[model samples]
Target: MSQGYAIELYFDPALENQVLKAWNVLARRQISTQLIEIEARPHITLLSSPSLEPLKLEGVVRAFAARQEPVPLSFFAVGSFPVDNNVLFLAPKANMALLQLHSQLCDAMRKEGVDVGEEFRPESWTPYCTVAQDVPKTRMAEGFCVLRDLKLPVTGYGVDIGLVEFPPVREVFSYVLGNPVEG
Candidate 1:
């Protein structure tokens, strides 16, 4: 059975290593990712929708990824919003580049006959990479503590994009942004 699909933003491996370090700390604290339920990776979720046909999804992703440039992102703070701010996450500061890519991708997906979900639309999206979800309120402070000294306000480029299935996310295709990183 195919897991549902989502459009996710993946960063350069170096930056991903940093985020995973924080996630490992969270897991050690006994904070469970029970809600998300997969051996999750660190990523910024751009869209989550029911599973689309693999070939169609791949074609859309290829076209979308090819025309898109790498998006620069800044993680400003650790935050939460799982069914009443219950999940803990890394919050990226909102910027025009991120917003525009989201809008464009959603539009393109819709035109390609994919029913892009409403929650992922430009009006309702809240961009974040979850660290842990479904934690007890009593442990919220502890969760934040795990990420406290993680080089906050970090800057990185979203260098890769993928279309994936959720619950147990499996990637259909991933496209690396071909733009060069500036020194």
Candidate 2:
């Protein structure tokens, strides 16, 4: 657990709660509790890099956040990174608005001398909010079964953006976007 940092887009509470529900189910069943243990809120990581400097990047994130509108997202499918550690996630429907937002954020970071690398670049990014991580290979199907019980297509807007440092997660900064959270 290295002290890595990320710029994340957080959901409005409604959407956040829905994502939490998936996490809760997995935890209750002993399937996965990685996010719960880390106390991570439901967020789509916009960019991640260890080279991030919180003090210098605050203004960059705030200014970039101010320039943007809330990005509408529909988590229409459930999937995972086909990687060794086994991550399960809710896949947001990729739309031009989301891609452009990611591109602009990356461009802003580059201007500040932070290269977010190829994985986060708009052309290669697959936008998903993680639900469970580090499940055993044999239990992957059980995790999927629990997630399938979730309502498909959790729809909402990403309303806030922030920077967090983690191992033990900590919020460095956050700014609500142009479209505010609706009750």
Candidate 3:
């Protein structure tokens, strides 16, 4: 069977910690069958496609790294996809550079014959940091109660990107594509 791969924009560890902290608080108050533990690195998915050869992946990452410059992003309010009632997320304040990067990445992936979901396409997208998934309605309400009262911190410059692999039946492995940001 073919493996699954996801090209995602990972948050620096500091920002990830904050998101985890919030998620932990919500998990404690919820009773849901969904996976509540925060395992994968916090990220805003750029694209997820079928597994590609290592060389192809390297080329894709290199191309993205070369064309895309780092940009600043801020986290704002908390929101939910009411229909799914399965995700609780932190919103990102509007940033044109981020949007443009998203668009460019999608375009690049398409040129390579990758099918990025129409629902996740640029124009209709709302950038967010997902905190929890598969949350039960009651728990979701409780999570909202807590998230609504809290103030989430924004990562001033979250420009790092990463490539992650999720095998058909194994743990996910992630690799950072660039150097760690200098303090």
List the candidates' TM-scores in order.
0.88, 0.94, 0.78
Candidate 3 regions off by >4 Å? Answer: 1-4, 31-38, 50-55, 167-183
Arrange candidates by TM-score, descending. 2, 1, 3
TM-score, structure 3 vs. true: 0.78
Taken over the whole model, the C-alpha lDDT of each candidate is 0.79, 0.90, 0.67
lDDT of 3 by residue, 1-183 (tens): 646666677666667677777777776765332334425666777766665454565566665665666657778788888676578888887689888878987887778777777666887776777777777766777778788766655665565666666643222433443443233
52 Cα displacement, candidate 3 (Å): 5.6
Model 1, range 1-183, lDDT digits (tens) per residue? 665777899987777877887777777778765533576667898888676776777767776787788888888899876586578889988899989988998898888877777788899988998877778888998888877778897778888888777666677778877633333
Report how far residue 142 has shifted in candidate 2, in Å: 0.6
lDDT of 2 by residue, 4-120 (tens): 899999998899999999999999999999999989989999999877899999887888888899999999888988799999999998898888889999999989999877889
Best-to-worst lDDT order: 2, 1, 3
Off by over 4 Å in 1: 33-37, 82-85, 179-183
Candidate 1 versus truth, CA RMSD in Å, comes to 3.9
lDDT of 2 at 30: 94
Residue pairs that clash (backbone atoms under 3 angstroms), model 1: 4-165
Q: How much is 169 displaced in model 1, in angstroms?
A: 2.0
The lowest-lDDT stretch of 10 consecutive residues in candidate 3 is 168-177
